[model samples]
Target: MKILILGIDGYLGWPLALKMGSKGHEVIGIDNLSTRKFSEEVGSDSAFPLPSPSDRVKEAKKILGINIDFYVKDANDMEFLKETIRKHKPDVIVHFAEQRSAPYSMKDYNHAQYTLDNNLGTTLKLIYAVNEIDPSIHILKMGTMGEYGTPSLDIPESPFVEANINNKKDKIIFPRWGGSIYHWSKIFDTDLLLYFNQIFGLTVTDIMQGPVYGTRTTEITEEGLRTRFDFDETWGTVVNRFCVEAVLGLPLTPYGKGGQTRGFISLEDSMEALRTLIENPPKTGEYRLVHQFAEIYSVNKIAEVVKNAAESLGMSTEIKHVDNPRIEAEEHYYNPEIKILPSLGFKPKKNLKDEVKIILEDLIPYKSRLERYKDSIMPKTKWKK
Candidate 1:
């Protein structure tokens, strides 16, 4: 299969490219390196040093013998994107090019607008480009479970729910209540994908994935092949932030009452799930909604797991409660379904403790590097300022 992965320089995108390339798929990658620039603007970076994208590509060929054609261009550029698609004619297009940080999106007006434009704009361009070039190409968009925003009801994997509003029995696209500008943009993308699928008969797969954590996948055999692991307040996921805090011997701070529960997946499992989906493309004009996550855990539980993992390595950190910066429920019902992946032979490779232990060991060697940005590890971006 020919696979074109946008944002291939990013954390998930880089590894996904390696995974596909290793499986003998012809892989094409594109990115503007905005994530690297965003990290610099936030006074932090990948805890481990990352080679340049070109260097990383060369390393993949050198170490893994996988060839990936990469382009350093923005996916929002419709002409360039359409030309590339027409040129490669890839079977599947994995879209990960977007501003993916909730806290960063909530920072300010410029940040919010940038998040909307970059995320939604890129998706709209991709939709039109695919429609113009090849409607049969499967677009696997990276969506977020954060779009649901802690509703009281159990979340289903199906994009639509059977609603009987005022005795009008009909199925409607599931309600989305995004928590931040970033999440709202993803919600917009979901709608765009569905609309395009309906109007232009485009094949789409919207992966409503949870927070992904873990530094090592099977494809990461050397330093240059490593994906980015951010641990700052703005860009870092909660698990990554906790692991970094534990490595630096700083307190593991959980927001508010520390009862915010959400789903999480390891990088390995995430890649596997994606690969499975790509191999099994949906029928023409079908929009497949998949809930991609391994386990459900509260923020407090994640902190505890990280703390225990660190303690096992003779590094100790206390769990501290802080005021929640985001306007979200600290405690809420969160039972999201996961029927698609398992039926497709997907199972979790590692549990939270094991994964955190691996992350701790990986970060122990980079303690000094983590220490340099320890000041930026705490919550500073507020939803209500």
Candidate 2:
């Protein structure tokens, strides 16, 4: 299969590209390196240095004998995106090019607008480009579970509800609300893909993923092939942040009541789920939704797991509850169905403790870097003024 992956420099994008390439797929990657730039602007760069995208590709060919074609172009650029698709005529298009940080999106008006434009605009362009070039091409878009907020009922993969109005019966996509501007953009993406699929017969798969945390994958064992790992307040996920705090002997900062429960997946499992979906794609004119996560854990439980793991390794750690910066339900019902992946042969090897232990062990060598940027690890971006 000829696979074209956008945002190839991202935490997941880089690893996915290599994994697919290793499997003998003709892989092409595109990115503007904006994630790295965004981290630099917010004083939250990756904990360790990462090689340039081109350098990494070159090294992969040198060491692993896998050839990956890379282009440093923005996916939102309609002209470039269309031309690339027309040129490659890809069998699969994996879209991951967007501003993905909830806190960063809420930083200010400019950041919010940028997030909206970059995320939605890119999807809009992809829809049109695929429609014009080849509607049969499979599009796998990355979405967030945060789009559902904290619904009262267990979240379905593709939710639908029946309604009756004026003695008329109809079924509609389940009503959803986002927790932040970034999540709202993903919601828009979901709707746009559905619209395109219904009208133009576009084949699409939207993976609503949870918080992903891990430092390594099978295909990314070498230094040059490593993916970016952020551990700051703005860009880091909770698991990553907790691991870094433990390494620095700093208290884990659990926001508000520390009862915000959310789903999580290890990096290895995320890649495997993606691979499973790619091998067995949805039929044309179909918009499929797969919930991607391995386990569910509350913020307090996550903190406790990290603390216990660190203590077992002869390290002291603490937990501290701070005011929640985002306007969200700190304690709410969160049971999202995620049986689709496992049914498709997606077996996750690591549990919560194993995942946390892996991250803690990986960060032990980066303690100096964590200490230097310790002050920037506290939550500062508020959703409301």
List model 1 lDDT by residue over 6-70, tens digit each: 99998899999999999999999999999999999999999989898789989999999999999
The TM-score obtained by model 1 is 0.99
State every prediction's TM-score relative to the real structure: 0.99, 0.98
Q: Residues 176-217, candidate 2, lDDT per residue (tens digit)?
A: 899889999999999999888889999999999999999988
lDDT of 1: 0.92
Looking at candidate 1, the ten consecutive residues that score lowest on lDDT are 344-353
Can you tell me which runs of candidate 1 are displaced by over 4 Å? Answer: none
Task: Score each candidate by Cα lDDT.
Answer: 0.92, 0.90
Residue ranges of candidate 2 with Cα displaced over 4 Å: 166-168
